[model samples]
Target: MAAKKKIRSPELEEGHLCYICGKEIHGDHVYIKTRRRSELHIHFECMPGKQQVN
Candidate 1:
């Protein structure tokens, strides 16, 4: 059987923008997450990005 990787503890910090939309977000409502351990990425809209011109 293949080896399993261990997940480290959750790391969070303020001003952590989303990797998707580059929006500013907090660990509160509409936070960021991932199934794998990459970067604590979030949505661009979730951080601080350009709003819709609508």
Candidate 2:
């Protein structure tokens, strides 16, 4: 049996670049920890299939 790598979230900085748009995150954004154990930052507007809640 093989062990699965655990995903972890790293601290996000204000000037961190967005993984999706490749732009600097200055305001609203989200961070995701990939299966490869890498942290990806993305802006809300740039997020794919993003929907607004009432």
Clashing residue pairs in all predictions, respectively, total: 10, 0
lDDT of 1: 0.59
lDDT of 2 by residue, 1-54 (tens): 999997656553346898977877886689899999999988888888887878
Where does candidate 2 clash, by residue pair?
none
TM-score of model 1 relative to the true fold? Answer: 0.31
lDDT of 1 by residue, 1-54 (tens): 999998765563456666666666665534545677555666545455657777
Error of 1 at 27 (Å): 3.1
Q: Candidate 1 clashing pairs? A: 18-42, 21-43, 21-44, 22-44, 23-44, 23-46, 23-47, 23-48, 24-47, 24-48
RMSD (Å) of each candidate, 1 decimal: 7.2, 8.4
